[model samples]
Target chain A: MTVTSSVPGAVPPPSTEVGPRIEPRIALSIRDLTKRYGSVAAIDRLSLDIASGEFLSLLGPSGSGKSTILMAIAGFVDPDGGDILLDGQPVGGLPPEKRGFGVVFQGYALFPHMTVRGNIAYPLKLRGIRGAELDRRVERAIDLVHLQAFAARMPRQLSGGQQQRVALARALVFDPAVVLLDEPLSALDKKLRAELQFELKSLHQRLGTTFVNVTHDQEEAMTMSDRIVILRDGRVQQTGTPDALYNTPATRFVADFLGRANFLDGVAGSVSGGCLTIDIDGASVRHRLRDGEPRMGRTALLALRPERLSVLAPDAAVGDRNRVEGRVVTSAFVGSQHIHVVETPLGVLEAHTPAFGAGVLRKPGEAVALAWPWDGGVLVEDR
Target chain B: MAKRPLSGEPYVGFLLPATLLVCGLFLIPIGQLVALSFGGLEAPTLRWYEQVAATDSIHRILLTTFRIVGLTTVIAVVLGYAVAYAMAHMGERQRLALLLCVLVPFWLSVLVRALAWLILLRNNGIVNEALLGSGLIAAPLPLVRNELGVVIGMVHYLVPYAVFPIFATMRGLDGRLMMAARSVGASPFRTFTDVYLPLTLPALFGAGLLVFVFGLGFFVTPAILGGGRVVMLSEYVSISVLQTLRWGLAAALSVVLLVATLALIAIVSRVTGVRRMLGAS
Candidate 1:
């Protein structure tokens, strides 16, 4: 029963990727956390270390235990086992209020009865700060969210984005040790979400407060997080920078979740010159192995991104790229890219090209060749 | 109905039935009551109103009515708030059970509930007998036969009125607000005062006003529980009509009670409705 929750791709690559250049002080650490509801476990034995002032995102689909992990860190959920530490001190005995970690709920839960000014002053007043100091702090907090003029308005009177800003201001007013956001931007329109993504990122930069965010939106996680920990069934599939996860996903799930992917099944061949040559449907393919040793003689799975493949005339110069001949089965123009579906001997493959410089759209049944670089694909664990 | 009306202006005939019913059933009767309070439709007089303003017993009765109704409103609202909070947070089964606890008694006849309280609260009743058996009192306490019994009966009858409105508002509130408050350095008690209590205040006041108006018109409970000693405004108005045959005085008291209730409704709706209970749902 526990085998389903185990991570087969737990072995990460050599951890020498140059991330943030700071001292990398550890701010929060989760150790062997486990939470179960009756017979089923929402979160398994998960461990994570967050750096000081780092914007870390727990990325996973619904019921993958991403929200449970965030709730545990915020002290809204009590784990059945293991411990949570804040700044290297165990905080298992603390409640949510005493934990000193601010949380922005998913729906922006603003106090409807209070004005914007009153909502922002709530935390300060609870801390026993009053009079001139309280007023000055509340003013600063409201100004930080750019909502000073609307301070007298009730929460329902404001727009959704304005209400979100007030919620954020209320959380950060007391200078919490850490801030947890549970899908903060999920309630906004797409354009507003994109705007606030950068706005929130810059806010984190200016404050230098450690932020732990939980989101199922891969684009949102990639846009705002300094590091991403992709979870599958309550276990970490991979934890790396956004660029690393996008380029070299450790599992088939991560690759498929992050972006469009083409999984090619092939048998592993001999390794030579830092390349692993494999045979796919009687055609040879080559992939540059980074640091991990190749799985020799066993069936291998290669994750090929669609944009890395290019369509060519059947008689064009192949150069050093791996080429396969096929017929154009479908063609489309999707805003910025011209997508072509080519049926080859191996399978139906796709190629995306820049829409502006892309010549003419390939018609159906046109003979074409698809070529990809040797290093464009990565070896991902099928598990 | 179509999306738009057939004409730009309202039909005007659509309001005929309800308007006619109101004018026939309500306005005409109220006009007659007002006309009777002055001597008659033909010859108007202020004698009954003058008598009311000058009499000491009328003043005492008005004061007594306000005091009893005010006390009943406060107790019922507080108890209702507590019950509503529990209903809002408890499990589904428990919440349904508690709702039945409020609703079943609400559906019971007001006379039946008043008598039930009499049976439990009277001297040598279950409460006094139990206390006597436990040696907690030397003699049977005067639990009924006065203002205390009247208040007890009225509060019991009015609690369901207070619970429904408050509970409906509580159900609409987002539970995340409580969590958000705690996440922002507010303890449980502080979160209640700072967030929960303030958010539900409009509903509280609304329920209080509803209870007060209903308590103002109460007659059966006070008549039975007051043991003929604690006569409220409603009971006095009854006496004026049935016992003394003073229809003019009865008509004047009825006008005063109705006007007072309407004035209170207007004032409360003004104060609590200023914000329109903005975002109350």
Candidate 2:
């Protein structure tokens, strides 16, 4: 892979260390898109602006309008209202072929009758490119996906991962303005899915083309996308960087969907020293105001990640961190980490601890104190 | 292995009745026919086959049969493909409606269907009377009792056969391939020609072969619609047997027709494997 990087016009190495580079120009903009079948709206009035050369993922479960948004952008589904703009030009009037955006379907959708070279050369041939120039582009695409050896093989003969690579190559061969992928890797096994996820992310970095991916897998979205748009019930629940969405989710659905979150329901008592104290049953818990300021005497929910809570010994010195006493309900060893479910006064809180030798293992029915920093718990609004 | 009693018999015992019925009903009759074509009991001579080859009328009859069958096959396939494509893309209820429409003719007897066409297509028939009344033509056109009538009747009868295989293949086709093609910048027309047409080629060939082979030996529709003006191979064979009592010539002609059909199937199966041609996938 490194050897080809020096070749002219070849893809450069994927920048693994740096974060997503935010470009100045917007490549595509979707405004007030709406699509309905019968009485159910598949895509409600949703709007989003995609930056150039950014890897954006629409992350959600099935029927969450993620795939609908991708299809609307690719011009496969006609929106009832609103417009889609490509480089500041309205493209809703154009057909899918004229829109000039490539898409990789869920099943790869490779031509079963055509060879790999023929499949990759299809779009170029449609544009009247022929002979030497066509061959050059096809060869370059084959090399881009590292499938030169399988250029003569049919789609059915290739493995699932290889077929996905061919699909990726074919989508890129036409030099489309943006590529839309609709769950392209969901067909593979877990190990191959992880491998292709890394390759897809690196491929985006090297090519620097705008990519729009729709997937239900939160981990995949977090690992590959520069920005994630969390959708639910045909509406945009939240949109932000992976870190922001994971760390400070704006809603209960966003917090629960992104990771394992333990919710603590309480009534806001009073505000003191930039912190809001909430009364859970009779115990008072303090949390920093991150998402929004809580109103006095109003109910609120706090999202605490399992990994954020640590089990502390009874004799441990308590500092500024919020502490709670609970009885261990059950604990399980999961190779690198141990998950303990504890019954607390507020609710059953789950804590994840590293299986390192530094901590003593807690047994079932044993009482333990759980502690977390004041800023660790995020305030989220109930849906 | 459970070591059942029938397992060691290689399953031939289960096939006994069917095998005996087929041999008695089909194979023995064919063997006797072939033997009769060689001048039965006369030391096996080629005089009957020679007589058939030497007859000028036989050449003309073969030509007419080929022309009619070829035209009917092509017409049925083209029309059937359009109907099948429509059905494949329709909603479930609409698709079922179309399927019933296609199957309605199959419920009618072939002779009844041919007689119905004869009533509608003959001179002074409903179609001609309507055309003459509308002043579309100055006189009643020749709509039946000719090659054109034979082709029309034959095509109608063969269309259902042509539709089944192509429709099966179209139903099995992944619609996403067409979407992928469009997404890759190919126009809708190009996507149909490049992706869809190629994928369905095997089934089309199978349907064409089926219609052609069936039309080759067709008897009822051509005899009724042709009104004795067009003498196809099957009708000639019947006349030779029933009218003239020329058993040897009839058997010779029948053998030739059978050989031609089988050879064509063999060649097509070699080109596209039979399973694939039948739209297995």
Candidate 3:
């Protein structure tokens, strides 16, 4: 099934006069929603707008309220106080079935008594689609998930990955306006999760339907989401494009959560034209601000990525940018790269450098200089 | 795996008593029952079988027994499912309170409970008194000495047994399955029918069968509540053996009742997995 939107009386005049309208419509809008179970808040005041046909991932650790947000939007858990709008209309009081959203739970939750065909045909049966058309849609759905050979098999008879596919096909069979997946790939192995991640991304593209996925794995969010919202303790840490979150984090929590980050605490000495001069161990270092640069005399935490640092020669006058003198305490070869732990005055800093064809490796106690460019550092608030 | 040798002899000593009990006491009685059904000192004959089949009142009594059992089973199952569903979703204290309420009726002696129902449903009982005092009825209703009282007492006895199995099954079921169904465009009622009801079918069948079999052997409620008007199979058998001194006819009727109970149990087991349903209950 294909989804094509044709706005009446809004046609293009000519090829030169037409510009692209690439952004999809907003399918679900959540505004200031909060839900509490007992004394602990499961979902704090969180607002998010999911665009139509866009695959959005709510990535966090356990108890970070990713699943709570999904449940709130699905109308399973009523928020203590806020509203959820679907397609510009309020639907806070509606039940989950009235929300018209398909959900694939963590374990797939396929009816064990139903065959593959019967499981896929359940939603259609509920909508009163019977006889020939029902059979046709069921067959099409089974084919869509590539489960033609297992159509008559029970859910338990299929492998974990196969059950997950059947769940996806069943969720999409009835043409739901949006699909919410709750840790759908968690039960599968690593290779299967990676494979299904691409399949889910492509399925979103093929169906042109909005998708909201919840997962604790950050890499899965980075690999699949059009936009990623990282949550912690029932509050959203940050929400942005994957690259934006990776390069520029607003808080130390967001920086440490999304990827590996080495935080350096120092006093912001001065600020000049988007650059902060910080005094580190009696040496002045000017670091360029990626975003949210701290003010003068304020305590600042700088996030430096492991891949951005390099081991330089001790006596080499490197003009690249900020540099620190340290000794390589330990190093390990990791196939494609060598992960080195350099003992510096700041602390033990991790540096990853590509292993180029039998090159000279740094041993323990070898004197070296750790250098990273100014643009590689991000100034984050002390959170 | 091979058995590991312990520092003591294999448990031949523990098995001696149970084995001797089964072979002597249990087997002897059953063998005697079988022989007595065929014949006793008057030589082998079908006289008892003929006597049991000849009486038209015996046939009517047997029919009444089955009808009361079947009706009680149906009513218990429906009400038990409702109560069990409510219990499954209730808070811990509420669930405990409901469970206590269910057990109170079951814990009371069947005779005592039946007497209580008689007191409540009699012509000048609390129910009729209340209605008459309120000017709702001109005359008292025929409630205690009829089929309705028999069913009411039997269901009150059997509902706790029915509810425990069904509630156990419902509690073990994954609540997420219902949520999954609802999120897939199913209404609350549809989710119940397509998901919750199907998952709980085994418990329903098992509980229904248990109540039905227990109903078949019912004696106290019907004997007291039927007031000698609606005679059931157990009461009739008692009269044939105890009052009329007809051992042959009683033996024949007892054999028929045993066979019918066994046959019903076998059919129930086949449909709803008898061994699993009745295990340790």
Candidate 4:
């Protein structure tokens, strides 16, 4: 499947268009990190290297150890058997204060007793900054987040979005080596969260500080990150750019977690010229083996994204596409797209089609042919 | 109810019992004391007030009372803040155990606790014996029957009061603020001074006010531990009434104490807002 804009015309151009590729320098390296709580490993021997000035996100579901990894990097949670290195220096023994990384907590964690200016001025003041220089830096930080007008207000006096901006300003004011965000936008409403997601991406581009965000929202991770790390059960499932992960997921969990996927269980019949022939419910299915080595006579699973499958009229030309006859069981109009659940010989398959003007939508119980290219299916390891 | 109002305002009847109780038990006695302080209701005069103002001993006693109360409040609040901070950061079982340790003195009577301290601090008591036995001093120290004994007893009594408000404030504090501060490059010491200490100020002030007000009216501990030497306001009032038969002077002193305490509470509430001063906010 290709990386098509999920919300067409609603999102701006992708962030990659603004800059050419630059050589990446390693900023922070987490080596062989392990943490356990009474025999249950929260982070089990995880290692990752974050490049300088790159926006990376640790994305996973609850209990997937994403937050634990973020905490370990932020020096809040001590790892049992690993070292965190900042700029090639081992900082595992350093306290969080000595680590000198900015962190934006989930709840915005702004000081309630302090005004916005005071909150933003805190880290600078701790560094013994005072007078005009401090004021200028604090003002610039507040201006960075567009919170100039609300600088005099207390945290409780501001709205949630405003509080989030204050938190952002406070975190960025110190100009640390990296900024760690723990689901910073998760507490916001949907509309505000989307707005901040766009703003955070733009801010990262403007500042060019290494940002490591932890979130369970797949769309959020995809929209704001330069690379996404998918984790499950204290282990790294896949780490790649959002497009790469979406188009070519390495495992069933990565495919299922990143977006919707339809799994077809089949037995491989033969392999010829890099193409694997499989039998699915007495029907011959062909899948192009891209980076996988599937063995013959073994059961295999193919992950087909719903958007890659198209529903056609019963008598439509198949034309070298993988076709299956199915009866439409349910169809839903989701404004921008139509989702149809079709009962087929292989099992139930979900298909998504863009909702254009006055298109023919198949009704329930109608016989329909679902067609997709052979390359649309990716061989994914079963979890 | 004679046809309750339809506006949904709080019913005055619900407050009637508490109001009657306060007026009967608190206001009337204070009113009587004020009236009696002015040379009784028959010929109300400011003779006792003038006499109290003229007496050097009354002035000295008032100064002594202020000193003891101020010292006790500072000592109790500082000690209580440490205990409360420790309790706030302890694990659940440890916090509960520390809380019990703080509160056990309350289970015993104030006079009993004062007597216990007397046994420990008297010249011939265990503390002096230990010190003398250890060659830490040439003679048995004068640890009791003075200002030191009274302060020790009062601070012990006031600490639990100080702990409750400060602990409440500490518990209400969001600990993540400290983490955020540390992440932003503030050292642990700086974080405490910059974030934690300022956030817990309201609790400290509230606890200080509580301890100070309670110490102002203390009688039992001072009477037991002072050994008739440190003449605080309460003991002086009792001496005037019981031994000297100066009922007017005693009444005057009581009126002054009541007025001073109320004025202090009013000023504190005005400064910090009563809800915050009580650590309720």
Q: Who wins the lDDT comparison?
A: 2
Compose the digit string of candidate 3's lDDT tens values, residues A1-383. 11222111233211110112226577888777889899998887766677788787888899999998898888888889878888989989888888888899888889876898889999899889999999999998888889999999999899999999999988999998889999999998999999999988887888888889999988889888877877877766667678878877767887898889888888777768767877766766678864434352477678889888887779878695888989999998888788889998877889888788653469999999988887778877566
- Clashing residue pairs for model 1: none
Q: Against the true structure, what is model 2's DockQ? A: 0.84
lDDT of 2 by residue, B1-281 (tens): 33464556766577878999999999999999999998896699898899888999999999999999999999999999999999999999999999999999988999999999999998889999999999999988898999999999999999999999999999999988999999998898999999999999899999999999999989999899999999999999999999999999999999999899999999998898898897775
lDDT of 4 by residue, A1-383 (tens): 11111111233322211112324577888877889998998887777778899898999999989998988888899889988989999988999998888899989899887999999998899899999999999999999999989999999999999999999889999898899999999999999999999999999999999999999999999999998878887877777788888987767888899999999989887878677887998987788777544442488888999999989998999886799999999998888889999999989999989889654578999999999987888877776
How much is the lDDT of residue B210 in candidate 4? 88
What's the residue-level lDDT of A182 in candidate 2? 98
lDDT of 1 by residue, A1-383 (tens): 00111232345433323233334577888888899999888888887778889898989999899999988988889999988999889987798889988889999899887899998998898889999999999998888889988999999899889999999999899998788999999999999999999999999999999899999999999999998888878877777788888898867898999878888889888889988888897888998887764463478899999999988899988787888999999999888888999999878888887788645678899999999998989887786
Best by DockQ: 2
What is the CAPRI rating of model 2's predicted complex?
high
Q: In terms of lDDT, which candidate is stronger, 1 or 2?
A: 2
Give the TM-scores of the predictions, in the order they appear. 0.91, 0.92, 0.86, 0.90
What tens digits encode model 2's per-residue C-alpha lDDT throughout A196-276? 999999999999999999999999999999888888877777777898788877678989999899999998877778788
- Regions of model 3 farther than 4 Å from truth: A1-24, A270-277, A280-286, A290-297, A311-343, A353-371, B1-32, B40-55, B239-252, B273-281
- Which ten contiguous residues of candidate 1 chain B have the minimum total lDDT? B272-281
Better of 3 and 4 by lDDT: 4
